[model samples]
Target: MESLVIPVLILLIVGAAVLLVARAVGRRTAGATGAAAKTSRGTPSGDPVETAKAAAAKLTEDQHRRLYALIAQGQAMAAIKLYYEASGEGLRASRDAVGALAAHPQPFRSAAPKVPEHDDDDAPERFPYRYRAIASKGDVTREVSSNMLNDEIYGRIRTLARSGDTEAAATALTRHSDISMKQAREFIALLDD
Candidate 1:
C-alpha cells in the first residue's frame, strides 16, 4: 500500500501538469484562430470608406457599373463573382472587396486624371476626334461639331450659360467650333438645364 501511494501521487501530479500544458496550448490556438478569423472576415483596420474606395479603384468603369448594379439588385454572390473575374484577385480577396464596396457606395473614379496637367485654359486643345454638341428646343434642333470641343469644353460652355454669362459662353463656343457667334448664342440658349 505505501509503495502504491507514492506512485499514485506522482501520477496525479503528472496528469495535472499535462492538463495545464494542454490548456495553455488551447488558449494560444484559440487566440490565433480568432485573429485569423477576424482578418478573413474582411475586418478593415483603417477607415471603411477609404478601404471601400481603394477596392472600387481596382475596377474599370464598366466593371464598376456592373458591380454597383448587381449590388443594387441585392445579388451579393453575383457581385462577388463579377469582382473576382474583373479584378483577377483571389476569391477571398474579391469577396472582401465586394463586401466593402457594398457596405459603402462609392462613385466611379477614373484611373487617369480628368484634366491634363499642362492644360491651357486660354487655348483650347484640339482632340483627335470631333465632339458634337446638340441642343433641342421644342421643334428646333441645333448641332455644333469641332475637334477642339470635347466634353470638358462643352461643360464649361454650359456652365457659363447657366451662370448668366451667355455672351462669354457663346464666345467660347465660337472659339472652339466653326459656328458663328449668332449661332453659338442660339445653341447656348437651348442649354437651360
Candidate 2:
C-alpha cells in the first residue's frame, strides 16, 4: 500500500507539471488555427500563413479558392509554392514560410472514455431506463470525410465561378450537387454557349 501511494503521487505530480507547461505554451500561440502558427502572440513576429492570407486577400476568386483547398490537404507549403510559382514570389521563401506554419500542428484531443454505470435490479430503482452512452468511431470518420469533401466542392465551385464561363460554372455546380459526373458535359456546353 505504501509503495502504491508513492508511485501514484509521482505520476500525479509529473502529469500536473506537463499540463502546466503545455497550457503555458498554448496560451502564447494562436488559438487552434492551422494558419497563424509561426510565433505565438506573446512572441516576436508574424508568420507565413498570415502573410499568405494577406496576399490571398488580393488574389482573384479562383486563386483564393485553390489556395485554401490545398491548405486543407495539409499542403500549406505546396499551396505557397504554387502561388509563388504562378505569381512573382520566389520558391524558397514561400515554401519556408508556409512550411513553418504547417509544422507544430495544433494538438488534437481524443474523445474521452465513457464509464458505464451498474444498476442493481433487486434494489430500489432510482430512475427508469438505462442511459447507455454511445459513440461510433466510424461516424466520426465519416463526418470528417464529409466535411473535407464539402470543402473541396466549395473550393472548386469558387474556382469555376471566378474564371470559367457561365455555362461551365453552372455545370460544375450541378455536378458537385449530384456528387456524380452525370450530365457534366451538357453543363459544360451550357458554359460554352
Candidate 3:
C-alpha cells in the first residue's frame, strides 16, 4: 500500500505539472494571436472599410486608379511602390495601406467638400472620348455611353447612388447620357453597392 501511494502521488504531481505547462502555452499562444489580429486589422475601430477609406483618401484619383489597376493585375510589389511614392509614406505604411485598399475596395472621394451649387447643375461637361458605364443586377444589364460622362462624373453619380441619393444620381445620369429618367433610375439602382 505504501509503494502504490508513492507512485500515485508522483503521477498526480506529473499530471498537474503537464496541465500547468499546457495552460501557460495556451495563454501565450492566444495572446500572440490576439496581437497579430489587432495589427492585421490596422484600425483601432477594427473596421476594414473605414481603414480602406482613410488610406484611399491619401491618394489622388490618378494614383488611386493606377494602384487598383496594379492590384487587379496581381502586381502587389508595383501597387505598394506606387502607393509609397504617391502617398510619400514609409514602405511599411504603404504596404499596409495597399493591403487594406486591395482587401476593401474604396471609391475615389475628392478631398474638397462638394458644393451644392455644383450638384444642382443640370449640364455635364463633354469629354473627348465616350465613356461607358455599365451596371448589372442579376440577369438584367444596362449600359450608358456618352461623351459627357467620364470617370469623375460617373464616380460622382455612383457616390450619390451609394449615399442614398438615387434621385440626384439618376438626374445626373440622365443629364450625362441620352437615357430617360426611368432608365437612369434603373441604372442607378444597380450601382447601390
Q: Kindly report the root-mean-square deviation of model 3 from the true structure over all alpha carbons.
A: 16.2
Off by over 4 Å in 3: 44-51, 72-74, 86-96, 110-193
Taking all chains together, the TM-score of candidate 2 against the true structure is: 0.25
- Is 2 or 3 the stronger prediction by lDDT? 3
Q: What's the TM-score of each model vs. the native?
A: 0.42, 0.25, 0.41
Summed backbone clashes in each candidate are: 0, 3, 0
Looking at model 1, the pairs that clash are none
| lDDT agreement of model 3 with the native | 0.85
lDDT of 3 by residue, 39-108 (tens): 3325422566776787898888999999999999999999999988887766776777788899999999
* Candidate 1: Cα lDDT at 85: 90
The superposed Cα distance between candidate 3 and the true structure at residue 181, in angstroms, equals 56
Worst 10 residues of 3 by lDDT: 37-46
